[model samples]
Target: MKRLSLITIIILLPVIICAYTYTVKQDGTGDFTTIYDAFTCYDVQQNGGIIYVFPGVYENVPLFQVTPNSVNIQIIGTNKTTCIIDADYAFYGFEIYNVNSNLTIKNFTVQDASIAGFRINSGSYGNTIIENNNITNCGFQANASVQKSALICHGNALIKGNTFIDNYNNWDYWAHEEFSLGGAIYIDYHDASVTDGLIEITNNDFIGNFARDCGAIFATSNQVISISGNYFEGNGLLESTINNNVPQYCVIARFEDCNIVDFNSNICYNNESYEVQMGPSHEQQGLVFKDCTVAQIRNNTINQNLDLSATEGIKGIMINATNDEGAYNIINNIVFYNWDGINCMNDDYGSLNIDYNDIHNNPPAGGNNNYVNVTQGEHDILYYPDLDPLTFQPIWNSSTKSRCIDAGVPNLFDDDNTPSDIGAVCAIKHRIDVVDLPSPSVDNGLKWLSFPSLDDVYSTSSYDPDKAGDLLFDILFPFEDPELEYVKHENNYFVRQWQGNWQGTSNIFSKTNGYIFQMNEAATLEISGFKVSDNTHIKLDGNSYENWIGYWLEETQTLSDAFGDEWNTGNIYSIQHQDWSAYYSEGTWKYKTS
Candidate 1:
């Protein structure tokens, strides 16, 4: 009988709890008509309950606020697309201030906000999760100084899987000449108040955003910014095209101080200046792009898909460490055909290894434009095609592939565990041709040879090394010097390096370093590569001896055999006579008439 009485009391507990619990709906089923109406009515619970928001456009006007200890406010949405909270002309779409731990906001779309999409300004000790939301056109008319991101907050936040497109500068549209650019997301660290902000912005797509300075994303502040596995494209807009007053300039990442900014496995294309532009000269941040000491920027593609400027200002990607010095590992990227592929201006003694990049067509004009330029004071080794160092041969001529292929340090191809290319793509030798060497040796050291293939001079028809992860096109560009003419050889011949003597066979071909060799006793060496006496030298036993018998010959025996004249009277070394001892080393040797 007592067990039945305890069961009866437990069944009545739900009846008592439902009588006091509140519900919010637009249809007027409860006391409140919208979700924000329950903020002041809901009390703190040990295990916080759910607040279901029905499908409708809830205009959050007159701005609701959540107090401290309002833990576990889970606003469950039926669907993100249908459940819209439009914050028109307001500073934030959803503002969370003074909330306790475990505040999850998900499965909702926040659009058309005046400032940030979702802002967390002064929250303390709360785990904020903002995921699976489509935030667009939020910061369309915000201030340039304060407008940083689509979904921005000051506390520790995890912003993942949310799409941020087109957070542009609308207020300063006429100031297009200034630097401002970012499309989807922007994270700034709060420094005035003493607090460290940590955020993880990953797995998001940023497309078609316009900021003259930082087109896709501009992150600055005294906070930790971690960016990985994201795609950025078409964020650079022409500031002049937008409006005369519009400020124009764009960059991917521009930040300063207090943490790590690691960019891994990302793709950035069609932007104006660079994928990631660091340093405080773009801004007045004290820490600048120096906060991230050990930056790991690897496995990315910074290609020039669409070029708007005729000059092609800075078509490829660049990394500039204007003030600080640390380990910057920039590996495995395919950068091609844009003024410069990879430009690193490190201001210290730290080493910069730019290995395994497909850098091509910088000047593209066949005269001067495409190529990597390194400023002085940077202790770095630049590996490019073979240069004569005197004549500067095979200057690429601004094509994707030229005869200057595989001319870099061969050992850096696959020796290290890092990526094998230099700028962005790795160049493979299509055909191997022997390089012209000053002298040949059995121990060629595997260094004096470069195989120039015809297939390496032209790019593959349909292959894009920047896309589809295939490097077939990178190996197909023809790498021949534009200034050279093609020639065909029929037979092999040797050139001798002698100037004068007696001769035998006319079989030796005349070449750059060729000369005549004496064949026998009455040999007459006829050197064809140089002029006779003044511009040439003739030596016996490898010494400049005085004419003892003939004119200018070190020995009269060599001159007497050529001119049949005595060493004393023959004008062999004369300007007009080839056997005159007076014009040779005069009075230096004894000559006798035969």
Candidate 2:
């Protein structure tokens, strides 16, 4: 066989690349003017590549379909806010059926569809990524009687960092039957086993989505599902005229057969119904097995969930399981300020282990009637966690730190060196130093001034001992007579004495550089010879005096050298600069001139 020359090989390489790229712009400037046109023109089965959609509104288009045998095809929008796909009267926004793996749809605003925003059929089984998109106002059909969702994924996928809002199904609005499963997302595996890799839903935000059943998410017949770091707010709203007796849930995962579900590090707040309703709600939750084996619910913050009915019972976490073979581990969570904290009903068949959780302020916190059978763990606290008002994070206040610090399980470690905190956020300590003047004391014929006390100083310092000792000085004396005389005492100290007629020369005490000068009127005097830390809160004569100091009264050090960590630097000093305008440098005091 003859080998091809270098020039011939280079010529054929371009044709054999097996990938093609196209662009879609609403303004007819890109390779294609519409997204439907790009999909129809590209031979995705033979060469799979990306279709980049610029920022613009593409309206009234058919379903953006990914044909079968299309592998590694990505439809990406430039921006989620600006790149809009408006399917006002279309059946669906995107339909991926029996497609090859690795299909990614990201960074787009998909809205106004009749059926759903994205529908991934069962045959597609790659780690498809649906991320950074805004899915809203879809799944509204009055005539059709079918369950609807913003996104329906039958294949293995990772849905992360997406926003689902205002998506609803109005079948109940016209017809008597309620056919709404999930307003935001629905994950269905039909009959697939748990061996399929888990479908991960992480870091997504679901808000204001409404449905009859599960408003935010509904997962059914899946092997393993991991839902973490997601925020669910104001979901699970039931129509007023419709059947209000049906239970509405923000997150519902029901597995008919044996499976493991891990739900952790999520925030579910301000929803209109149950925050989490897991396991089969049927069977009256007796001793019979419903196939779910392991459920780990930990590190979540749930709060303020209310139902439409004024007298209804709302729960932050409601687990109804009938399987005696299953094990439920609920630990290290914050379920506070809600209507009910953990309602575990029909959990007698399963082993319930609830421990290390901060559950407080709920109407009736954690009861067997509510489905929480806390057999082994410690009871939840009733005090407030002292969370930050703005961020809702646990602040470093004494009430929060004393109870939550190092309060997790025996083996698990917190972010700090202590044990884990009993909530989603760990407590971190912050140090602040305060300095202020001490009270004056008199002994014999002399009066002495003491140094200021350091407040909230916890640990020992590595600064020089001599410099620390020199921070205290005695220099004040009382003068009661009309004529005052200057006298020199032992240890080079100076004193003020009463004279009958005349006073010593002005230059007598002037020669002593360390003597305190007594003045009739309030004058600015410079006094120096002490070391202090910068950034310290200083007070003089029982008043705040931080503005009069020229330079840092305390020695400055780098963050690494001061804290032994690279996060905080500079010493904080609070010095009271009253009538004296003075500062210290190199262990010496100097008065500032007016």
Q: Which candidate is the best by lDDT?
A: 2
Candidate 2 whole-model C-alpha lDDT, 0 to 1: 0.57
- Please report the TM-score between candidate 2 and the true structure: 0.62
Candidate 1 Cα errors over 4 Å, as ranges: 1-25, 29-33, 38-52, 61-73, 122-124, 142-149, 173-183, 190-197, 237-243, 246-248, 272-291, 313-315, 337-339, 345-353, 360-594
TM-scores of the candidates in the order shown: 0.52, 0.62
Tens-digit lDDT track of model 2 for 184-288: 887777554436666789999889887665667777644577888888777764452444344434333333343677888787766754322334442111111
Tens-digit lDDT string for candidate 1 (349-443)? 24455544444454344314333354322322233433222322223322443332343334545332221333222234222322322211322
All models: lDDT?
Answer: 0.46, 0.57
Span of 10 residues, lowest total lDDT, candidate 1: 481-490
The number of clashing residue pairs in each candidate reads 81, 21
